[model samples]
Target: MRLVVAITGASGAIYGVRILQMLSALGVESHLVTSRHAMLTLTTETDWTPEGLRSLATHVHPVGDVGSVIASGSFQHDGMIIAPCSVKTLSGVANCYADNLVTRAADVTLKEGRRLVLVFRETPLHLGHLRLLTQAAEMGATVFPPVPAFYHEPKVIDDLVDQTAGRVLDQFGLDAAVARWEGMRPLRERQDQQPDHQAALGEPVNG
Candidate 1:
């Protein structure tokens, strides 16, 4: 387990932070690279400082350091993940534009045939967004949007974040304690367990 992780200028900076924390807990080697705007998002969206975020990774590379080890295909690693991947970064990856370290590493990941997971954080996408995502997928990148699931019944924001991060790790075959979706209960069983909505609301239940 060695992985390259990039945090781009997306709203959910916490996704990248959670992934780093989990990777550290799992004793995985993580090479982190954060964009300038990602640092701003980290501070704006969460209390985590750039220094704190750097401490979670085994190594931290500057966003412009295209000559870094992870930028080359020969730097054998398990995979790369661009958590909270911005559409700008997505475009770069889709177009094989290696202007920055994040895109460069992603390019190398695809060229090396290693797993490249993009935790895209945009919503209400237009045709161009879809096209870019499709192109990246065709190039072997996993475009994973951080869509929250309620099957585990999240009680807090952190739970939702953890679930998304865990699911991302799942793509790399790492277990982050994500709630697996088992077969649903039988319809009759579910109905039997359902509470009386009218009674709960203090309304008289019809016979």
Candidate 2:
């Protein structure tokens, strides 16, 4: 399978990084593009250098290269994912602003009737943010928020990152085997074993 992965200037660069890693492991071809500001976030949020990030993708495109093959609807990709999608990029896609390769690729994906997943990273959203997200969704794009799942019993940061990345891959019909809810037993077990603690933490114990 082939996919386009874009990283923006959002706070969580790791989501983009993890998505690339998951795609690589699944033997999926990834066309990577990163906004210029994404470099700053990458350095601030991860130890990986720009070179290292490019190494994860099957092909790397310059963010300014709107003429690249992936920018066209005929490029034939399974979908496009904008992990850690910033509001700027979201607005661009929502408003049909294709000034860059990332947004252009996304626009192409939508026009081609292929999946376009946006892993929006902002929080405490205002009304404008909600409207942009709604607009993107109405345009046949999936706006995925990378919210952590405590039910997975994540012990480290990687666990949380991997779970979210895995779920994003799920949109492409790729399975990364990241922790997922198998049944109610796990939650029931936790509830039965730690009712007081669950109540104290304001966690639901029963359905």
Candidate 3:
């Protein structure tokens, strides 16, 4: 599967890295783009350089290189994910203002009726942010903020990123490598565990 993974100037750079690592492990082709501010934020927050990130992608292109293949809907990508999508980028996408290749690719993804996942990484959001998100959603984009549920009992920051990435990957039929939450306790009994019990032809036990 061809996946376009973009990193913007958001604090959760690790989410973008985790997405790249998982996509590589799953043998999905990753086309990467990082905005200038994104590189600055990455180096300030993480160990990888812009070149280091380029090494992870099958094809890495400049943010301004609108001539890149992905700028066109015919390039045939399964999806596009802006992990750690910055509010700036989100606004651009929301308005269909393809000032650069990142926004153009996202526009292409939406126009083609393919999946576009924006891992919006802003907090203390204002009403403007909500309005932008609503606009993006109305345009058939999935606005996935970097929020994880506590019910999953995430142990580390990576755990939270993985769970969210996994959920995002589900839309593309890619495994996020995070364990699924079956919403029940594990079944075990003296070395013989029963299959997960879903209600059958009886009065359901709400266990």
Candidate 4:
């Protein structure tokens, strides 16, 4: 499957990086576009270089290249994802502002009636943020915030990143090795066994 991926100026640059990594592993064709601020954020937040991040995708387009193939609606692809989508980018998409390649591609995606996923990374949003998000959703965009799930028992930062990336791929019907929740039965059983094991070890158990 072919997809257009955009990395914007958001704090969690790793989300976009991991999405590219997973897409590459799945042998998916990815067209990547990274904003200038996104590159800086990547450098500040992670060790990945701009060159390394671009290498993961099948094609890389400049953020200002509005004439790129993915910017047009005729350039058919499965979908588009703006990982770590900044509020600025979100506003552009919501307002149908095609000033750049990222927003242009997103507009084309919506116009083509294809999936448009926006991984909005901001938190503690105000009313304006919510309104913009609601507007985008009303325009057939999926506003997916990278909220980490603890039920999967993430052991490290990478685990959390991978889980969120995998879930994002899931939106496209692509499955990754993310842990799925079966039910509460297993967790309850494990919790019950935990106390016994602690008692056997003569460890102090909290009531």
lDDT value for model 3: 0.87
Between prediction 1 and prediction 3, the one with superior lDDT is 1
The C-alpha stretches of model 2 lying farther than 4 A from their native spots are: 186-188, 191-207
lDDT tens digits, residue span 20-94, model 4:
999989999999999879999999999999999999999999998888999888898999999999999999999
Models ranked on lDDT: 1, 2, 4, 3
- Arrange candidates, best TM-score first: 4, 1, 2, 3
Residue 152 displacement (Å), model 2: 1.2
How does candidate 1 fare on TM-score?
Answer: 0.92
**Where is model 1 poorest over a 10-residue stretch in terms of lDDT?**
176-185
- Give model 2's TM-score versus the native structure: 0.91
Query: Candidate 2 on 1-207: residue-level lDDT in tens?
Result: 999999999999999999999889989999999998999999998899999999999999999999999989888889999998999999999999999999999999999999999999998999999999999999999999999998777889999999999999999899998999866666676766653866677888563
| TM-score against truth, every candidate | 0.92, 0.91, 0.86, 0.92
Candidate 3 lDDT, tens digit per residue, 88-178? 9999999999999989999999999999999999889899999999999999999888788665666787777788878888888877668
lDDT, model 2, position 29: 93
Score each candidate by Cα lDDT.
Answer: 0.94, 0.93, 0.87, 0.93
Candidate 1, residues 96-167, lDDT tens digits: the string is: 999999999999999999999999989899999999999999999998999999877678999999999999
Worst 10 residues of 4 by lDDT: 190-199
Instruction: Tell how far residue 128 is off in model 1, in angstroms.
Output: 0.5
Error of 1 at 183 (Å): 2.2
Go through the candidates in order and give the clash count of each: 0, 0, 0, 0
